[model samples]
Target: MAPVTNGRVLFNAIPEDYPVPGKTVVYDTTETIDFENVPLNGGILIKVLLLSLDPYMRGRLRAPEIESYMPAFPLGEPLTGGGIGVVLRSENDAVKAGTHVRGWLAHQQYYIAPNLSMLEVIDRDSKLDWSVYIGAAGMPGETAFAGWREYSEAKKGEVAFITTGAGPVGSMVIQIAKQDGVKVIASAGSEEKVKFMREIGADVVFNYKTTDVREVLKKEGPIDIYWDNVGGDTLDAAMEFAAKHSRFIECGQISGYNQGYQPMKNPGLIFAKCMHFHGFLLAVLRPKHSAAFQAEVVPKLVSGEYKFTEDISHGLDKVGDVLLAIQKGTNKGKAIVRVADE
Candidate 1:
């Protein structure tokens, strides 16, 4: 067993109004590594290996009233999100020591978790990389599946458009949609990402920053589904090209995140086309579809029917920089912080 010591917990205490220079992360030390003695009963102690840096985390740093999905990160405490870790110790029969699991964990090297009902034990012999659990095989993978199935109801031979096409979830969505005989039109911020999108099965890929999104969509013809990731102007442009009775899956609004918030410029387009715009959160699908997703998608992942990409950053100290990079569209695929070596 690794020697226990006071663990460091990192948090962004003050929300940044705009891009701030230098270390924005604040660190604190905890006395006990064991939460078994805490008032919350049957908790486990986790030695974290990987932590996910996602766009949704940006919303968490803001005031709670501004967003209804998740609570704001409180002052003087560690922020939590999806992570993969090993159970160092456990007070629950379901969770045993040394078991590999993934769930929401604080941004720290080690922490005593009180309740982890969302946690799942990872299969070590699954023939897939463990990091994929936090990427393709994990929430992002599940999100793509659920979002497509629920929002799009995508059928064979339909045309699907996914924004932020080269990222983990967008790439997976493109692959899955293509396999179903759906033609995919994907948009990215850069030419490299646009090229990567085509490499990953996008029927038509365009760099929104460089190319005319509406013109490209016009050339592609009427799209049946739009899996939106980068919202704002991109979403507005996509709306102009959406087919009648088309489904618009609002996955993430990454474009407006840095601006604090931006008003939708083309709300009228949705009504004119009678397009169905469904906003999705992955957590909502967990209760009803977790079993099906695991049974159907997990096995296929092992056989390589589904693929994922990751932009791994070494060390826990670089968490802030990595997150900023993701926001700035610098990191490729899913941005993951490797907290400890396997």
Candidate 2:
């Protein structure tokens, strides 16, 4: 067979603020690969079907010298993240052709999986949509599940405040808390998102763009649990209304991801309120909680008992745009980009 086009999203340059498509990240369509001639080298050739566009990816667009939990994106290379794909050819005995896989995958239509340690073969008989493996049933969903179980010491009838409640992590957090009989007060950036949050079981939902977060919290909250997703000011206000010994699950801070660092206004509240402010890493928690999460949530997802929303964009060109939307809090749900059809 002749060489086929291999489109990819490349990290072109580091950004000071929000990454700009075409400049900071580029959708390059110049590359190609011959299916017949490409060497397997004890690896497998995969056709990527879905790629997750997440808020945390913004942290990866940095100078290589600076270190974090994850490495910076090397310039002039494709971005990589949680993805779902099908193996088209395999030289490795453990991986067979025509099987679906979920793991760290490149931001391209085609990829070569040289290391199989990180890859997990998905069940083909499940009959689930490929997007589910990259969105609702994926990293973002697991992050919410593991984070809540590890941090939230929630009590029945307690008030819980969740910022970014319509998002993948926040949406799941809202439902999980409600199931445990916790009253939830959550916020979103748009009216549509606010409505979605309410439908998913938030006792009180508001548009942060049109309403004041502090005012809403004052009226309905003396929060016992704070599921924090955005950190700058909303976090401060949640602290103001926090019940003594409140548990704070410090997740991603999308608010500060694109801007210069802004210190919290009253961090001393941590001591005064005796708040258990804990930040978590998904990588550390995933291995411990993955099986439990699948057992508990997968059936619910299949039965439509667990509700979710996916803000998906199609094509490799949409990666940068969707990622930018995630940083700005404009996306309605778990941001994803579809690269190919199964």
Candidate 3:
């Protein structure tokens, strides 16, 4: 084993102003670990290949007092999130060198983990691409499955509506629902996204920005399940059209992240419809249902029963721009930063 230097980007604070760009600074540091000196409990070094830039990362950029499921990234440290990397040198037999793995960790060129239990060994025999591990086969895919299965309890032949249909998680929800014989009604921000939704098997897709959601959903008939990724007006409109005993999975609220906070305007619809509105966090699901998810959902993805779209940005330096683009709803699919190639 040889000495190696790693470069990483650190997030310092949250932006106070709307459309205020978040700050990231890249710096280099050296590692001191050799095969002979590797700690008994220490895992070896890894070189990150792909990093996920999700809407949740915005929440982490805020201060700790915000008190979300995930704590805020501390100032003067590398920001952490879900990522795919290849093990370079490992003292732990469970995570051998040369294996590609996905884990929750700091955003960096390389990481040194002391037997991080959060890291999982990716099956190299699988035909899925490495990027899929960070996208459909990884956290986003699991989030979609857990949210739908545990919260919505969706059934066949029912109508499922998803906001932000063009996004990675939303798109997968549409496909999974359709595969299970559920009819899907989806809403995206643009015409191109509407078309993309249809291409991915959304039964009916609408441009929410231009079209009236209440009108479009009404024409599509009753919505039995509503996966609300966009909050505020889109959520309000979805509630209005929901059928009796409808299931609403509140996975995210990207619509209000930039605008600070907006009051909910349609509380009456929930009562009228008897809708089951539930909020979901993926980190929580990991402990509660990870085994079931790996057994049930991972196979579907590996077998091609589920499809995914990647909205990848090249280079680590562009991570700030990619996060900004995703927040603005510019990225078409799962926004990822390609740090290196496997």
Candidate 4:
């Protein structure tokens, strides 16, 4: 009978470099929703519990005219990304009230999903936390799994190098490589992150900020597999020291996402070494590898054999700040915004 506050994080402007919290993205609470009276139209009304803020979202903040893999964020609208929520009302038989769902959701406190095809119904009684679905057990986890399983084919005892190694995807990459007996050399931005990489089983870990990445690679490398997340100078260095017939998984280029395209100093090394360099989209790979990833990884996650670090901040207002932190590689592990407690 009463209207409830429905807060939202809206995209306000296209940033020249990094998005500015409260300016480029604004938190608006002026909107109100009649929760009980809202129309579902053969779908569901959800109370958003959590939202995943990954590095890939940075590319979505550009002008609508600019074409890319994912569509640009429409100005003055709620930003959308991978999130988990609880359904309060449903008009569809497949989805019922009180069920938990995971999918791409608008960055708002509450939303009405008119379509159920993309949204997945998750068990509400699962032991894993809701936030995990948006991070280690979700898209980021899948990306890391696919990258290592399909792209990086380093044999046991061979060295594998992973950039941005403490974050969600890289952390998974590190653990997967270790499980297969591959020696992992990983880099992070801070000492804390370097420590985290070691804890996750990276054989050789270093704070790329303090130690020269190029020098470290030269000593620890001639790497058989290079899983690159930050692709500017670090990638250039990896190319220089990469072993003959090395496999390079070009996952993300967060280092230059805000600064624009960064040219490689020696891309010719790929040809000279007869290396395998591949860039993949998770959307393309998930259909092929998701079932296996879930079956193999989820059990390990539950048993505590595999670890995932989550950097969580609360409130809808924090979405902009979290995304900015992700782009700069400042947040630890998988950065998530806890919108509401489940």
Model 4 vs. true fold: TM: 0.97
> Residue-wise lDDT of candidate 3 within 1-342, one digit each (tens)?
585445677775566633344454343344344544555455667888999988877777777777877787886788788898888888787878888778876678877777768788876436877888788877888888778778777788888889888888898788778867998998888888988889889988888878888898879858889898888877777777779999889898887777665667888878887878899788777677678877877787788777677888777776777877888888878899898887
Q: Residue 232 of model 2: what lDDT?
A: 83
List, residue by residue over 33-131, the lDDT tens digit for candidate 1: 443443335788788999988887777666556756788777556768899999878887888888998988888887667766768787744598778
- What's the residue-level lDDT of 296 in candidate 4? 94
Q: Rank all candidate structures by their TM-score, best first, as comma-separated numbers.
A: 4, 2, 1, 3
Model 4, 51-163: lDDT tens digits are 99988888999999999988999999999988999999999888888899999799999999987877999863266888888878889889999988997776889999998
Write candidate 2's Cα lDDT for 1-342 as tens digits. 889999999999998899887788899999999876899788999999988888889999999999888899999999999888999999988889899899999999999999687788987326457787776687878988899888898789999999899998898889888888999999999999999998988999999999998899889989999998898888889899899999999997888889955688988989998999889988899988899889987777787777888888889999888878888887877888989888
Q: Look at candidate 3 and tell me the lDDT of residue 173.
A: 83
Cα lDDT computed for each candidate against the true fold: 0.79, 0.88, 0.79, 0.89
The best candidate by lDDT is 4
Indicate the worst ten consecutive residues by lDDT in candidate 4. Answer: 123-132
Better of 2 and 3 by TM-score: 2
Superposed by TM-score, candidate 3 places the C-alpha of residue 203 at a distance from the truth, in angstroms, of 1.3
What is the lDDT for 323 in model 3? 73
- Per-candidate TM equals 0.91, 0.97, 0.89, 0.97
Runs off by more than 4 Å, candidate 3: 1-5, 17-41, 287-305
Q: In angstroms, how far off is 67's CA in candidate 2?
A: 2.0
- RMSD list, candidates in order: 2.6, 1.3, 2.8, 1.2
Model 4, residue 54: displacement in angstroms? 0.7
